[model samples]
Target chain A: MLQSIVHVCLAGLSQGMFIWLVASGLTLIFGVLGVLNFAHGSFYMLGAYFCFMVLRALGENFWWGLLLGPVCVAAVGYLVERFFLRRVYGLELPYQLLLTFAFVLLFDDLVKIFWGAASIGTPPAPGLADSIMILGRRFPSYNLFVIAVGPLLALGLWGLLEKTWAGRIIRASSSDREMASALGVKVPTLFTAVFVFGTWLGALGGGLAVPYLGLLTPGMGEQIIIEAFVVAVIGGLGSLKGAFLGALVIGLLSAFGTRFLPTFDMFLTFILMAGVLLWRPQGFFGEAR
Target chain B: MSKKGMNRRQFVKAGLMTAAAAALGPAVLKPTSLWAAESKVKGPIKLGYQTVLSGTLAGYGEFHKMGAIMAMEEINTAGGIAGNKLEIEFRDSTLKAPDAIQNARYFVDSWGADFLAGIDSSGQALALAPVMAELDRVLMVTHAATEKLTEEQVFKNGVKQIFRIVTPTYQDGNAAAFVAKDLPVKTWATINPKYEYGFTCWNMFKETLSALKKDVTFTAESWAPFGTTDFRSHINTIMDAKPEGLYSVEWAGELITMVKQGIQAGLFNQVKHVMFPVGAAMDVLEGLGAEMPDNIWISGRYYFLYPNDKSNNDWVERFHKRWQHYPAYVSEGAYSTMYAFKKAVEAAGSKETKAVVGALEGMTLDSPAGKRVFRKEDHQAMYDVPWGLTVSNPKYPFKIMGKQVMVPAKDCFARPPFEGPGTKPPFKA
Candidate 1:
């Protein structure tokens, strides 16, 4: 029983890490831009597809995909922010929402045209396919790698945000956009940079997740986007720390729920979201407007 | 103000007449015009094909379209159905129930389709089944496999317009049980998508298996929402239960994900037997190629290399020649449905909807899947269910079924004339 509990916890933690990776990006973008960026999930999908294409074309280590997939997605993100998103900065929230949602449909069709409608699978990276014995039971090494990534990324992001001048500028701008611009922070350029970085984070999550999930399908982004949104909301919109916590809560709930209450697994996440909304509308870490 | 100027009462009367005309004009004129135009069935017999043209299930729809296209081309080339050229108008359902119903109506009302066919999801099939009766049109369901469409919805709802070319889920479940009884598996667990088809599949398999093997126990059950991308937690939960065998009803992309993740988690290492009723689909094999493990049991509605008959082999060759990829069951279902429609039309000696429905009730026709008989009682096809073990064959790039087990339709199918456990007479009568 104890071992089973341990297994569930480990599975939950690893799953949470992936959710955190996605939710963090969404939260970050919302925090700085005050736009929901519904296409955040599309970037993640592109990451997976791009990584798969790279791996298929250049037969080498999986590292190639990890290194280049996010870069490609980041470039696309940069262009999207510079051209389309730039126009919507001063518009109503609905326009920004509608514009981002349009990107979702556009990318969905684009993926179908390029990748075809069939799902594609990538083989496990070399040396990561096997399982290792843990707590007298076998656990996938790939999941361990996934679990480790969340904390590593969180620490890196913390350092960048807290210690560096660029991070300081970004923080200042997000908090006081008018003041930052008055102080010569190049507000438009900073917004673009932040959007691109957030997109890269989403893409990185997708690339990292594809090998473990083992299949990539068009509209896969839409499936995960809702869960990511729930996490972002529960953790407090735009709060990176809250996103992590929310992901963990949802992931663990999913894992344990499957064991104890198989029928309500899908509803469990929503129930939590509802509870959070009822109790704390702004979210755990969110600031009042 | 002279003879042209109107009094206040006269002006009010003219305004009311104009408002009435504006409100009722289209409703009265549109249908009459459409009926007048559509009543003349002069040139070709049109079939309205509705299925998922986008999303994860698109492959099934694509294959269905391919198979239907091939059949239409052949028939058109060799003197079309009853001297009239057969053509299909395709519509994307997007795999939603509302969209499928809307598409079905559009096909019948707007395009004047002689018949409606093609549905990838069972839910769509169930939703559209009732609509067929409302439209007073015959709908040949090509791919959706829910037993409820024929067993409950057809008989209980008095829906005679719907007929399924694919084997019902109940029959497949019974076949699965037969295969399970022969194997060395004892304790069984199931992981299926949470939906009508999945639940019905699991229940039928379990009930039939329990009847066959008195000692068999179902240790664990897991239900994942449809189109779920992650199955790690589900996998861990199943592994913890440690069932000797697993039955998974997940199909297409979701199945690919589960199998691959199962391998990574070493779940297969612990479980002795695993069966995927729809896993032998060409798309699944092609997607997983070389990574698909050997000895795992899989079943398909139709396999390209099965029946080992000459005519079946010829059809396979012809399909491969044109499409370059082996046809999945959905493809065969669509192909056979077109031929079935042709046979029924020829038998009835008319393309009228009521006549076609009557002819199709107990029709027996030759298809690529060998001979199929649509039961008069329920309108469900009675055909062989093919199951096999996955083996790496040298001739094919992907894994092919080896040591094939052909479950005879006689043993698997329910008795006819609304005699099944869940079947009932129409409440209206």
Candidate 2:
């Protein structure tokens, strides 16, 4: 009984962490910027494709791909905020969604044009390709790498937001944009920077996923984005803490659901999201309006 | 009065002209060549082709386009069928049955398509069956492999307008079982696509294998939904089942991910025998490259290297030269389907739907996949596709088959009137 429990948890934890990596950027963007960027998923896809390209250019050097792939996404995010998203800051939610959705279609086609329709997957990280026996179940070390990275990123983000002056200004703008503007916060530029940072986080998740999933596809972003949205919703849409815990819960629920009730596995995540919203309408961490 | 009705003299003159032309035209137009022989056949035969073009499976559509367009150009360059120029319009089916039906309607009613080809999803193909009957246009299904399209929709329902260029579940399941019965395996498990194609293939294999060997047992099953990126959980399920053999029906990009993940989970080390119904597909082999583990039995609707005949070899060379890549089975099926249309039109001596359907039944054509006979009963093309063990070849970048075993189509295909339960077998085990 214990062995099965541990195995399920391991699977859930790894899956959840991967999702957290994507959801972190989403939660951060929505929290500070109040922009529900639908293209966040596209950013994740670009990260995987760029990383795969870099790996190929460097003869499959995975670390180089990991470090450089998300950096490229940061550059893309910068272009998006400076030119496109900058125009939509004062608009309503639907306008922002429509604008970001355009990027989703654009980026999906761009990836296809540049890389072709077939998938190109990265090799497992150096020395992390081995499997460890976990309670009589063989679990991949690459999965463990992903699991470890998720919490580390969460800690890094927590420190960056809570421990720095830039973080304070960003928080001030997020809470009261006019007051921060009056106090010389340069809110527009700050918003751009935050958006870029969030994009980088989403891309980092994509980079991590290349090895974990063992393949990069054009619309993989669309799939992961749906999962991230569920995580963000359950964790409270704009709450980082909520996203972190929510990812874990969603991941574990999906894993256990597949193991125990295979037929209902598809609905388990959505069902959890609905139940959580009914009980704590603001999610676990979102402030009550 | 003259504008509204034909005058007596005008009607008499038209009748005399028609009779004179009919008497003299046959003697003047001598068809020494097949195209010249059928002077009555029309010009500019229009074909509408549709397949998935926007999703992760978009690569399949690209391959379909390559083969169909290549054949169109070739037929046109050689003076076309029965003196008619071949023209083709390509559309994206987008993995939806409704979209496929809409495209079929537009192809026939709007684009004036005389014939159609290229459907990648079995759901889309099965959905288009009744629509084809309604439109009264012949649809040559290239990639979809559901047996129900042939058995239930075509054979049982008498949807004569639908014909498939690719082999159906008979090859994937029954032929696969014929190969497995000799492998000394008693128990099996499967991870299949969670759709009609998956369920049908598994059931077909189980029924045939059980009938062939009474002692064989199926231990467990996992059905992965379409577009499933993560397959580790499914892999674990198969591992726990611990069957003597594993059979996976995953294909294309999904299969690539499954194999890579399965290798990481040490699936190859645990299972002594494994089989992939569509593992020999070009994209999977090319995507995995050196990562693909050897000795797993694999087969597809068509293998580019099989048949090893002069005609097939020559065509593969031309195809590689043109596209700079080897042909996938869809491309082969699509390419052959265009030629099949040409043959039918020439045989029937017209581009009419009823004539073409009649011409296609029991017709044989030499293709890159060898001789394909459009069976008279169901219109499903019957041909030999061999099951081979994966092995690395120095000449090719990916793994090629090492040893291949072929069960003759006569031995494996379900017999006539192909009903679900009552269908007879071509030969007793």
Candidate 3:
């Protein structure tokens, strides 16, 4: 019984970590930019597909994919922010949303055209293909690698945002865009970089996920986007810290809900979202309006 | 203004006309029958086909199109059906029920399709039953495998316009049980799709397995929702229960994910006996390729290599040469359906709906999947599909079934009424 509980918890943790990889990027972009980039999930999907390309090129080394897949996605993010997203920065939220939503449809169709509508199998990470014994139960090592990396990346992001000068400029621009521009900061360039950084995070999650989930399909990002929004909203939109914890909470709830109360599995996430909305409207870390 | 515009009396007349339309039919409007009454049933015999054309299972649509078009080409080359030039129009039916229903109507009403074929989902097939009856167009269901489409929709409910070319859950559930009962396993667990097809198959397997074996118990079950990318939690649940055998009815892309993840989590290592009802599908086999674990049992509606007959083998070679890919069950079924139409229409000597249906009722046709007889009772094609263990064959790139077991259809398929345990060999669990 204890072992089963441990298994569920471990499974939930890995699931949460995967969601965090996607949610972290979404939180950073939505929190800082006040633009609900619906295409953030598309970025996550592109990460997986791009990672597959690299993995196909470089063999099944997990590190090669992690190193290069997000870089490609970051390039995409850079272009999107510079040409398209740049036009809608100060525009109304609906305009930004409409543009991102259009990209979602475009990207999904583009993937189908390029990759075809069939599912593709991804090889496991080179050495972590085997399951290790945990609590007298076998668990996937690829999952363990993800769980470990989720927090490490969170810490790395924290150090970058808190200690670095570039991070300070980003904070300044996001909090007070006019003040930063008046102080001679290249605000548009900073926004582009920040968007690129967030894109990288989402892509990184997708790259890691290719080996973990071991499959890719078109419209795969659509489902994750809904869950990530729930996590982001619950964690207090834009709060990186909030996304991390919220991902864990959502993941565990999904796992347990599917197991114990299978009927409520679909509604449980929304119920939590509704509860959060009724009580803490600003989210776990958002500033009160 | 008074001459052009409506007065109170004119407005009331228009309102009455609107209310008449509203008060007419309780459900579906019956204009399809009048449209069918006007159908010329002459010149070219047009067939409208639709399948999952743009999602994860979009490959299925490709396969369906390949087979149907191939068959259409062959027929047109051979002077067409009933001395008329056979014409076909393709539409994306999508996964939704309403879309499928609309497509079926469009095929008959607007597109002037004499015949309709290739439905992918059982939900869509069931939804189209009454609509097909209203349309009076003979629909040959190629992919959807829910038995209810045949038994309930066609037989019980008297929705006779529907006929299934593909073998339904009988092969997946009861025939699987008949094969599994001889094995030593006792405890079984299942993870299946969350919809009607999944539920019916699982129940059929459990019911038939229980009847066949005295001691077997269903230990655990996990239902995977549509578009489930992860099965780790379901895996955990099954492992916790520690069943002797795991039977998963997950098909296509989802099955590929489940198996790949199963290998990673060592689920296959712990559970010695694993059976995938539709694991032998072309998409699953091609996707998994060399990594598909050996000795795992798999079955589908039809396999390319089965029958081991000259016609079947010759058909397989031709299909590969044409499409550069082996035929999936849907492909074979779709191909067979086209031939069935030819035989029916030629035998009837008319493209009329009633005449073709009459000829098709108990018609036997020779095709790639061997001889298929559409059961007059429920319009289900009674055919053989084998269950076998996966093994790498030198002739093929992907894993092929080795040591195949062919269970006779009569031993597993339900009797005429198909009501319950009292009426059939395999019943609801």
Candidate 4:
């Protein structure tokens, strides 16, 4: 019984990391730009498809995809912001949403046109596919990797944001955007850079997720985007720290709900989000700004 | 004169020209006019098919439409029923029930379709059910497998014209039950989408298990909303429960996602037996590839590997050659339903709605999955439901079933009282 609890926790932590990867970017982009990129999950989906295509073209070496896929996705994100998003800069939220939603449809069908309607899934890395001993039972090694990497990435991002000039500028802008702009921060260029950076994080999440989740399909973007919204809202929109904390709470709640109330398991994530909203309208770690 | 008089004047001018052609010869004139008359079969027999061409279940809709088209072509080539050529028209409702009902009305009343059929979801069927009666049209239901369509919620007025060829949802649930009971598992956890069909299957399976074994317990269960992409949490929960058995009623892409995530999370390793009600689909197995582990029992409405008869094999080959994709269960059901419709039309000796319905009610037809006969009681087809375990074979690129069982319709179905009050059930009995 005790063994099963540990297993569940490990699996939940692994999943929480993946959620954090995508949701943190969501939080960062929203926090800085005051624009919710509805196509963020579309970017994530693109990352998976890009990785899959690159792997097949360049041979099935997971390492190459892990390094290069996000870079390529980041480049695309940069182009997407420079060309298309720039047009919608001063527009209403609905206009931004509509444009991003259109992109979602476009990218989804594009995946279908390229990969067909069937799912594209790859096996886990051979060595990490098997389970390692945990709590006297075996749990997947890949899950352990995910659990370990999530906090490391969070800490790394925190360090970069706090310690570096670029990080200080971003932090300053998060507090006082007008002041940061007046201080020669090149706010427009910074917004574009931040957009690319956040999209890269999302893409990296998608690329790394292929081996763990297995299949990436057309409508997956739509599903992920909704969940990302839920996570971002629950964690306090525009707060990276909030997203990180929210992902953990939602992930654990989902896992625990599944364990205890398997039938209502799917609703747990949303239920937790609802509970958090009722408690804190500004989100746990988010400020009014 | 009315607007109709202008069109009549134009026709008379053309006729005057044909009269001039009579000067050439009586033979040439008669032959030309007869050829013209024969060449055009008056407007063709319009059949309406409603499907989900652009949603989560689009794959199912696409394949079913392909099968329906194939059948329509074959019927048209064979000089369609009672010397009337077949014309099919399709509308996409995006798989939503209200949209489907609206489309159903449009096809029958506005589009002037003489016959109606085709739907991908049971919810759509329910929405269209009452309207079918109000419209008083014959709808040959093809792909959707909800038992309620033919049972509690059947079209009240158009019951006679509404004929279902596909087996009910419970047929699938019953097959899962039989397979699960045969296995060595004691405790089970079910993961199904939260909807009628999903609930029905889960309930039927639990009921069957309870009836079969007194001590079986369900340790955990999960009902994810339809179109849910993530299964990580559900996987963790199932692992925590550590049940010996797992049954998932999820189909198509959702099932594919669940299998991949479940395998990665090591949930399958924790359980001794897993029963995926619709996971035996070829597309899903091929997509999963190495992720599709061994000893997982799965069930589908049809298995292309079954029947192995020369004719069925030839059909399979021809279908593959044409589509380059393996036939899914829904596709097979569509094909077989068309064949059943053909057989029923022949038996009735007329395309009159009631006659066709009568002929189909208590008739049997051969299909790729052996012979299926519609039970006179509920209009549900009595055929062998295919169930088996996923066995990876080098002979095929995808996972194929081994230890396959053919649970007859008798085992997988129950007698129908259908609706509480019915003037005449869709079934003849």
Candidate 5:
């Protein structure tokens, strides 16, 4: 029983890490731009597809994909923000929402056109395909890598935000856009930069998750986007820390729920989200408006 | 006397009537000659094909499309169907029930489709069944495998227009159970998608397998929503249960993910027999490629390389030559559906919907999967379900099943009409 519990916790942690990776980017984009990028998940899908293509073209060197895939997606994100999203920045929330949603459809169809709507899988990286015995329970090495990377990323992001000048400007712009512009912060450029970075994070998550997921489909983004949204809403729409907490909560609930209440497992996360909303309508970390 | 009152107009009409009767005298005497002339110049037979054509399951839909198209081309090449060419109007259902129903309506109302076929999801088929009855059109279901679509929902509701070409969930489960009894595994666990198809499949497997292997026991069970990408938590739970075998109802992308994750988590190493009733599909094998582990048991509605009979092998060879890939079960199903429609139309001696339905009730035809017969009582086709063990074949790029076991149609099913106890009790809403 103890061993099983440990295994479940480890599984939850790995899942939570992936969820955090996706939700953090979503929350960040919403926080800075005040536009919920519905196409954020499409970027993640593009990352996976790009990574798979790169890996195949480069003789299955998974490392090359890990590095270059996100760069490609980030470049696309830059173009999108510069051309399309920029026009909607000054418009009402619904216009921005509609534009992003349109991107989602556009990207989905583009993937179908290129990838042929078939699901394809990428093998795990060399040396990470196997499992290791931890505390007498077999756990996948790739999962452990994911779990380790998540906290390190969180720490790095924390350091950048708290200790860097660029991070300070970003924070200032997010909190007081008009004041930041008045103080000569170049708020527009900062918003674009934040959007690019957030998109890069989303794509990076996708690339990281591909080996574990082992399959890519055109509709993959649509499946995960809802979960990311749930996490963002439960954690407070714009709070990175809250995104992490919310992801972990949902992930653990998923793990334990499948074991105890197999029939109602899907509803467990929604139930938790509802409970949190009832207690704290603004979310645990959202600023009171 | 009339001529005294009539002018030149009456005289002209009389002369024209005499000329018309002289010209049409032979055709009026023998109406069969006129009908024969019209038959030679008959209009094309139009079929409306709808399925999930643009989503994750699009691969399945694509195969169905290819099969239907190939059948149409082949039929046209062979002087068309009774000298009338077959044409198909394709639509993407988007894997939604409402969209499927709407598309069915659009096909009949707007396109004047002679018949309707193609539904990849069971829920979509069931939703469209009543719509078919409402439209008074015959719907040949090619891929959806829910037993309730035939036995309970369509049966109890008296929807005779819905005919299933592919085997249902119970048939597949019962077939897999035959293979399971011969295996040495004593304990098993199940992981399936949470839906009508999944539940029915698992229940059928359990009921059949338990009956055969009385000593065997089920240790754990897990259900995930359809289209779920992640299965790590479920894998861990099943692993903890430590069952000797695992039966999974996951298919397509979901199955690929689970198998890959299971390998990574060493779940396969622990479980002795990992069986997937629908995992032997070409899409699954091709998606996983070399990543698919050898010796795992998988089954499908059809196997491209099976039956080893000359005719079936020739058909498969032609399919590969035309499509440049192996045909999945749905491909065969859709292909056979077109031929079945042609045969039924010929038997009915007319293109009327009711006549075709009557002709199709007890229709039998030879297919790539061998002979198939549509049960007159329930409108479900009876054909062999193939299951086999995965092996790495040098001739194929992906893992192909070896030690093939083709469960006979009679063995996989109960007596016809399927009016037995309900497979699943209706929801008390």
Candidate 6:
């Protein structure tokens, strides 16, 4: 029983990490840009498909694909922001949303044309393919990697945001965009950078996720996007710390939900999200105005 | 001598033709041009296939579309059904109920389809089943396998115009149980997608397992929502329980993900036996490719390469040639439904919906899956449900079912009499 709990925790952590990657990106973009990039999940999907194609053409070293996949995705993200998202700045939220939605369809069809309408597999990393002994039972090492990386990345992100000059510029602009512009900051460059950075986070999540989930089919982005939104909402839309917390809670809930509540497993995540929203409208960390 | 002989032969032939024409007189003079002038080309019959075409279960919808196209082309080449040609118009359901219902309306109202068919998700079927009753048109269901369309949940008076080509969930679940019992597995873990059909499969599989092996124990049960990309936790739970066998009712996207993740995590190596519902999805098999281990006990709605018979081979070969991929169960379902509709239409000799419905209630149609007859009692189509051990074939890209066994639909299925006149039928599980 102890062993099972430990295994479940590992599973939860892996799932939590995936959610964190996307939610963090969503949070950062929403915080700094004040624009909800609805197409954030599409970037994640591109990373995954990119990894699949590269690994298929190359070999099954998920780590190599994981490392290299994000570069191209980041480049695409930069282009998408420069060309498409730049127009939507200072515009209504719905316009930004609609444009992103169109992007969702565009990327979805592009994947279909390139990959065809079939599921493709991604093998687990070579060394991490084997399960590790934990709490007197075996658990997958790939999952352990995910568990360790989530918090490490969180700390790294924190250091980047709090301790660096570039981070200070981002924090200043997000807090008061008009004030940052008055202070002679390169406001437009900051916004573009934030959007591109958010997109990079999404792609990084997707690339890291490939080896564990192991298949890239069309519309997979849409499915994960909903869950990421739930995490973002529960964690407070623009709070990176809240995104991490929300991901953790959502992950554990999803993992244990399937085990204990078997029948209601499908609704558990949404039910939890609803409960959280009812209790805390601004999420766990957001200030009640 | 050779040149002179050839010249003599040519002259003799010309002389003979002139003599024969002269002897035949006016009869031979009749215009050979009349027959050539009378030849006329007819237009193709357009069929609108509305289905879940681009989501997690998109493969099923696409398979059905391909099957319909294959059947239409094959039939058209053989002079078509009653001298009319066939074409198909497709719409994507996105695996949503409202989308499917909307597509149904569009197919009938806007597309003006001669025939309409499709559905991969049973939820979509339940959503659109009422449209069949409302519209005075025949909607041949090819892939949606939920029993509700044919049995208990079917709208009052809806059964008349609706015909099912795919075996319902319970029927397919029963076959999985039957095959599992033959193995050494005695304890089981149930992991199915968290949905109506998945729940239905769990209940039916458990019930069937109980009946087959009364002493068998169920150790754990897990349900993941449709399109669940991660199965690590579910696998951990099931593995912890240490069930002798595992029953996974996941299909298409979820099934492929689970198999790849579960195998990598070493669940297959630990479990004594494994059986996945819809284990025959080509997307799952093709996705897994060489990584899918051999000898996992699995069953699906259709296996294109199963039958050794000539007719089955011919159809399979033709379908493969046309589609460039193995026909998943959805394609088989669509192909079978179209043929059933064709037979019904011919028998009724009218495009009138009621007449076709009457003909279909007790119809038996020859399909690529062999002879399948709809049971008049429940409107559930009956045919051989093939279950097999998954084996990787060097000749093919994906794992194909080998050591196959066909359990005749009648042998495994019991179309219990409908709970008549207001008493609710027992909800499965």
Stretches of candidate 5 exceeding 4 Å from the true structure: B1-41, B420-429
Residue A212 lDDT in candidate 2:
81
lDDT tens string, model 4, B369-392? 778887665566777767888887
Q: If both were scored by lDDT, which would come out higher, candidate 2 or candidate 4?
A: 2
What lDDT score is found at residue B268 in candidate 1? 81
- Residue A146, candidate 2: how far off, in angstroms? 0.8
> Candidate 3 — which residues are off by over 4 angstroms?
A60-62, A90-92, B1-41, B420-422, B426-429
Candidate 4 lDDT over A126-170, as tens digits, reads 467776777766566877877888889999899989899889999
Better of 2 and 6 by lDDT: 2
Q: Return the TM-scores of chain A for each candidate in numbered order.
A: 0.98, 0.97, 0.97, 0.95, 0.98, 0.96
Off by over 4 Å in 2: A1-3, B1-39, B420-426
lDDT of each: 0.84, 0.87, 0.86, 0.74, 0.84, 0.76
Model 2's alpha-carbon lDDT is 0.87
Error of 4 at A243 (Å): 0.7
Q: Per-residue alpha-carbon lDDT of model 2 for A1-289, expressed as tens digits?
A: 6656677678789889988999999999999899998999999999988888888898888888999999999999999999999998888887898899999989989988998876765688877878898877678988888888888989988898889999888888888989999989998889999999999999998888888878777888988899999899888888899999999998888877766677888888988888988998888898876
Provide the TM-score of chain B versus the true chain B for each model in turn.
0.88, 0.90, 0.90, 0.84, 0.87, 0.84
DockQ, all models? 0.65, 0.44, 0.61, 0.33, 0.54, 0.41
Summarize candidate 1's per-residue lDDT along B261-306 as a digit string, tens digits: 8887778888979899998888999989988888889988888887
lDDT score for residue B3 of model 4: 56
Candidate 6, residue B122: how far the Cα is off, in Å: 1.4
Residue-level lDDT of model 6, residues A193-265, one tens digit each, is 8887888889888888787777777777887788889999999988899999999998988888776666676
lDDT of 5 by residue, B174-282 (tens): 8878788899988989888898888888888888888777898988888989877778778877887889889988999999999888887778778979889888788
A1-289: candidate 1 lDDT, tens digit per residue? 8878888888889888888999989999998988899999999899988888877777845668878988899999999999999999999988898999999989988998998877777878767878898877777898899899899999898889889999899889999999999999999998999999999999999899778788788888887788899999999998998998999998899888887788788888899899989989888898866
Candidate 6 per-residue lDDT over residues B1-429, each given as its tens digit: 566899689667645654654476347424432332244322344567877767555556667778887777777788776466767788887878877766776676556565678777788877776676655467777777777677754434444667677777755577777777777888888777777888887777877778777788888888786678888878887887889899887877777778877876678878968887677777778878888878877677777776668988888787788878877878788777667766765676644555566777778888888878877766777777678888877899888888877666765665555444322212232
- Tens digit of lDDT per residue, candidate 3, span A1-289? 8888888888889989889989999989876777888998899889999888887788667678778989998999999999999998778877898899999988878888888777787787888878899877778887888889999999998998889998898788778889999999987777888899999988888888888777888777877888899999999987899999999999999888777776677778899999999999988887787
**TM-score of model number 3, chain B:** 0.90
User: What's the interface RMS deviation of candidate 4?
Assistant: 2.8
Pairs clashing within candidate 2: B31-B36, B31-B37
* Ranked candidates, highest DockQ first: 1, 3, 5, 2, 6, 4
